[model samples]
Target chain A: MVQFLQQIVNGLSLGSIYALIALGYTMVYGIIKLINFAHGDIYMLGAYVGFICTVQLGLGFFPALIIAMVTCAIIGVVIEKIAYKPLRNATRIAALITAIGVSYFLEASTQKIMGTSAHSFPDVLGTQTFNVLGVVISMKQIIIFVVTILLMLLLQYVVQKTKIGRAMRAVSVDADAAQLMGVNVNATISYTFAIGSALAGAAGVLVGIYYNTVSPLMGLVPGIKAFIAAVFGGIGIIPGAMFGGFFIGIVETLVTGYGSSLYKDAVVYIILIIILIVKPAGLLGKNVKEKV
Target chain B: MKKLVIALFVFAMLAGCSSNGGGNPAGDGYKIGLHYELTGEVADYGNAELEGSKLAIKLMNQKLGEDKYESVEYDNTSSTTEAVTISTKLVQDGVIGVVGPATSGASAATYQVLDGAGIPVISPSATANNVTQKNPDDENSEVYNSVFRICFEDSYQGAAMAQFAYDTLNAKRVVIYGDSTTDYAKGLTQAFTDQFHKLGGTVVATEYYVAKDTDFNGTLTKIKDMTYDALYIPGYYNEAGLIAKQARAMGIDCPIIGGDGFDSTTLVDLAGATALNDVYFTTAYTTVGASDALQAFIDAYKAEYNKEPGMFAALAFDATNLLMEACEKAGSNNPADIQKVLVDIEFDGITGSFSFDATHTPIKSVLVVELVDGVQASAVSVSPKM
Candidate 1:
């Protein structure tokens, strides 16, 4: 039981990172109906930025994290404007292809610059483990959970209570109607990208601390997994992505802890298939009739 | 349209007439082929070889001048097909001998082609048994005539470490985490497992992961309940370092051992000082050394490049000098003569003294290097009897 609880602690720590990245995927999908494949690379960029801030610029962990989030938010807005905005009226497939292109572009360019080698991410969260009820948890794991929950609450408050949030919701409902209501459609879309990218950036810094290593291609697998998390919980739903991230994380950790790790990815995909079979719109998604 | 076609044909002819650097040399200098990875996956090792070999060539040129060597350089970019192109290009350009593609796959690709051409090709560090030994099962099988290497074969390293683990570290039960993608990793894994069992050590479990995987907590957790005295991971430094870090984080205290994959400076940095405790690996040479000859080479390398020479540098230096020595012994730069001379020559190097065994691989002692306080320190030297 202690071992099981310990695995849950590991799962939560891992899941929070996925949750943060999944929020980005879910938000962009919510606003534009486009899956931003480069969202994962944004997380990678955040880690790199944080690395530079702390290592070369000699800033504290929190300062580096904030700097990375701001930098990524700006980058996210620019990427949406450049890559997706022009293709707004085009087919969804085209936008997805561009997102994938952007993802590869970020990976290749970073590999060219950084030389495809791993860098040791500085230890920000001190190396200390605390025992609670026979289960030991690291300091970084605690930070991941607390920060992720706080950010999710803040995100919920922003979307529910703010004017921009209302505009975002209106745009997601009907872009033409939102434009008629004077919502400034382009600005709302850009705001969505900024928020999503900032969340991904924060996740990137936290993951770098937990993993203690960073590489150019570090975002690829995690990005795919986070996307899976987003889809596993209704893709465009806010609460769903968060719940899905934690769920996948816990399931993955438990599977590896008690079962064969070679089948972890296979098991995750199988669960997703079962979930989709039962609820075609995702776990929390409503079945809505649409014009074909 | 006719005039444009004629003009294009003339331009193409003129482009082909241009001379590349290192293809031609004035006076009585020998033209050697510099075949190493300059811009690919293993470019770091290739770059080190280039630096060390270039330094050796420069110093040799200072003494020989006009009889100094000019090299036609080819960067394989760590691909076998690219190695073929470069090997052919080197041969067509008339190099006396070749000094490295820096990896077993690259060497395997080009060595047969170079051997067919009867050119002597020496690899700085390709360790796979088939790299030097074309016929593995036969005791008296003829060695690959034109192919030779300065590093010990793959089997030697794994066997040495296995002996060290049983006799020195006193390990009994082991778990192996092998990289299933590469022949290098697979070969080391097989060799280590065979030797370990031969020495009465039971392998508890074997796990495999592909390269580029950073997450191993899954594997760590799976192995947590299993009983194992040591972890033998046969793979590169990146994943090895990550495994060590994850293993420690999961509260596993068993000593981790591996082959030459854990040699890089990045291993210490990635694993940290505390995580690296009791981590050991076998490699060509110990980085922490103070021998007069080794120190002289190190000092000279540091003076020239403002950095300590990695093992690749030392190996490439030996390869370069070995090529030069063979050329001198043969009294000509002819491929046939150089190949003939190398078959019987013994060269002493900074890594260790070695001559070609029946397999065309150098016979040398493999060092069991251990990580102490995150710094690579020499642990023990194992001489192979098999």
Candidate 2:
């Protein structure tokens, strides 16, 4: 029972990270209805920015994290403005291809600048284990969990109460109606990207702290997983993204703990495929009536 | 006027003949090709091997003093297909010998190219046992003659590490993890498990991860439930670093052991100082406890590159020096002559004294290193019992 509780705590901490990253994926999908593949590369960029700010420029973790978030937010806005916004009327495939092109370009450029070797992120928190009811948890895991929850709650408040949040919902439901209601549709899209990119930045920092390493290609797996989480919880649904992230994390952890570790990834994908087949709209997604 | 024209013509003819002599000579200006993975996942390994070849060529030219020989370099992109393409290009360029494909997988792909050309190929780091292990009765056995390795085979390293874990650390039950994508990981894991079980140790659990995976929570949880004395992760530093960190996070506190792939400083940095404490691995050489010659090489390397030489660099340096020694002993620019000399030659290297065994693998001592606060310290030498 003690071991079971310990694994749960571990799973929760990991799930929180996935939640932060998945929020970025789901948020963008809600507003734009396009899977921004470059979103993951933005996370990688955040890690590199944090690395440079902290290790090279000698800033503290909080300050470096803020700078990383702001920098990534700006890049996100620019990318949406230049790449996606221009192709809004084009086929969805065009936008998808552009996203992929942008992702590859970012990865290659970063690799060229940073070299192909993995860089060591500085340890912001000291390595000291704290015990909680016969389960020892590291200080880093606690911080990651706390930060993730705080960010999620803050996002929830923004989307539920704020006027801009209403505008975002309006845009998601019907872009023409939102513009008719005096909402600056383009501005709302940019704001959505800014918020999503900032969240991804935070996720990148948490991952670096948890794993103790950063690489140019490090964002690929988590990025894909977060997208899966978005789809699993119901794409375009806020609470759904959170639920999916935690669910995937727990299921993957349980599978690895109980079954063969080699089958962990296989299990995650199989669950996604099965869920999709049974309920195409995802766990919390609504079924839409086709105009045709 | 006729006599003056004859003299001028003779002078022009002599100059043309001398320029042609400088360009090419019959069986004199031998070309040695190098195929390495200079880019991709294992680029670091390829870069080190290439640097070693460069250093060897510099030393050899200095020793030769204007000898008519040239080295041609090619990038193999760490892919089998690329290695094959590069080997064919090298053969087309009329290289008498080739230095490396840097990995067993790549070497296996390009084996036919060099074998068909009858050009001897030597690898600086390819450690797979089957690389040179040929079927004696088969007509294609001659394909094995053209290939050799400067590093110890996986069998030697596996058994050596297992014995160290069993006898030195008294580890009775060990868990094994490997990367499924790499032959290096698979070969080392198989060898270690075989030797450990043979020595009456139980493999409590065995797991695997892909080459680029960053998470190990699932695998770590399973291993944590069991009672294992040690964890053997025979894979490269990229994934190994994350595994070490995640294993610690999951509360699997057993000491993790690995092979030469863990020699990168990046591993220490990736795993963090606290998590890497007590982690052990086997490597070719360490900057600490180096021989006098090895120390000089390190000093020169530091002076040249403005950084300490890692184990890959040291292995490469040794390989180059060994190749030069073979060239000198052969006293000819002929591939067959160099091949013959290489088989019988024994010389002290930066890592240790290296000589070829019957399988064309190097016979040398392997060093066991312990990680102290994310830095490699306390290196001890081990030799295979056989």
Candidate 3:
């Protein structure tokens, strides 16, 4: 039971990172209906930025996190405007392909610049562990939990209690109707990317600190896993992505802890299949009736 | 417009002809392919091996009093498919033999492609057991007769470590956390487990992770509750370093032992100095107790590159020298001739003096290097009791 609890602790730390990245995937899908495959690479860029902030610039963790988030937010807005905007009217598949292209471009360009090697993220939070009821938790894990919850709450306030948030919901529901009702759809979409990418960037910094290693290709697997989490919880649903991230993280950790690590990915996908079979929409997603 | 198109086409042909004219001078030397990971995740290993191979070639040329060898080099970027592509290009360029693609995965890819073309290929650090022969566990497995290596195979190194852990360190139980995605790690794991069990030491738990995986805390937490005397990680420095850091951070301060994959400066950078205490790994060569010949090679390498040469450089130097010696013995730069000579040749190298056994693996000694406070303290030579 202690072993199980310890695994859960590990899972939560990993899941919070997935949750942070999943938010970006869900928000962009909610607003523009594009999958934003490059969302993961943006998270990777955020980690590198954080790496520079802490290692080269000699900033503390909070400052590095904030700067990384801000830098990624601008990059997110620029990517949407330049890459997705041109193909807005073309085809959804076209935009999706462009997102993939953007992902590759970011990875290749970063590799070309930084070289393909892993960099050790500086240990800003010194190692400290706490034992509660035979379970071990580290200071880094606690920071991850605190940061993720705060960001999620801040995201909740932005989505529910702000004018821009209402505009975002309006665009998601009916872009043409929202435009007719003076919603400024393009600006709302850009804001959506900004907020989502900022969350991803924060996740990146957290992961760098937690893992103590960063590389150019670090975001690829997490990006796919987070996308799966978003879909498992109900893609395009704000609360669903958060729930899905934690759910997948715990399940993955438990599977890896008890069962074989080889089957962890397979088990995650199988659960998704079962969930989708029961409710075509995700666990937190509502089934929308199709209109012809 | 048609006339203009024809004129442009003619101009392009002329440009291509001029570029082709600036190629290698005819019959100046024999072209030996140097395919390696020049710029990728394992670029450190590749570039070091390249330097060693270049140094060997320089000395070989000076001895022969002429440029009897020329390197046709290509960077595989630490990719298996890229290694295959480079092998095809090397074959097309009429190279006699190829020397690299340092890691086992890429070396395996090149061997599969080059074996069919009857090219004699040598890998400096592709230590996986099955690189020369397929299905090392099976007796009837096919062998890549033309493929060979300079360093001892992974099984030898793995067994050596297991023996050291049991006999020298006096550990009765060990837990293995290995990389499952690479043949190198799998080979080491298999040999270590078999040898440890044979030595009457119990293996507590065996956990696996793929390359690029950073989160071992979940798995580590599970293993923490288990009873184990030592932990053996059969993987590259990237994941091993991270595991060392995490393991130490968790206060699981038992000794950690590994194979040659842990021989990299990046290991120190990744794990940090404080976390690397009581770590041990098997390597091909060490400066701890160097022979005069080995020290000479080290000094020459230092004088040439102004940096300490790692194990990869030493192995590649030996591999290049071995190949060039075969070429000289065969009295020709023919792949078939070089392959025939290699099968029956005995070579002396900085790493050791050895001849290839039936499986094309070198019968040589391995150094088990230990770290004290994250710095190399001592290396003791050990032979696996196979």
Number of the predicted model whose DockQ against the real structure is largest: 3
Per-candidate interface DockQ score: 0.17, 0.24, 0.36
TM for candidate 1 is: 0.83
Model 3: iRMSD?
Answer: 8.7
TM-score, each model? Answer: 0.83, 0.85, 0.89
i-RMS values of the candidates, in order?
9.2, 14.5, 8.7
lDDT of each candidate versus the true structure = 0.83, 0.80, 0.87
User: What digit string (tens of lDDT, one per residue) describes model 3 on residues B1-386?
Assistant: 42245346645754653453233532335887888886655665787798899988988998889987877777787888888888887777777889997888888888877888788999999887767887656746888889998888888889999999999999999999999988889999999999999999999889998788889888887787788899999998889999999888877899999988887777888899999889999988777778997888889899998867777888999999999999999998778889999998999888889899887878888989998877889999899898
| Fnat by candidate, in order | 0.26, 0.52, 0.54
- Per-residue alpha-carbon lDDT of candidate 3 for residues A33-130, written as tens digits (9 for 90 to 100): 99999999999999999999999999999999999999999889988887899889888999999999888767755665665667899999878889
> Which digits, one per residue and each the tens of the lDDT, describe model 2 over residues A1-292?
7667777777787788788888988999998899999999889888888888879998887898899889888888988887899999999999999999878666655654576678888888777888888887888888988888888999999998999899999999999999999999999999999999999988888787677677877788788888888999998999998999998888777777777777877898998998899887889988888898
**Sorted on DockQ, highest at the top, how do the candidates line up?**
3, 2, 1
Candidate with top TM-score is 3
Q: Which DockQ-derived CAPRI band holds candidate 1?
A: incorrect
Candidate 2: residue A100 lDDT (0-100): 95
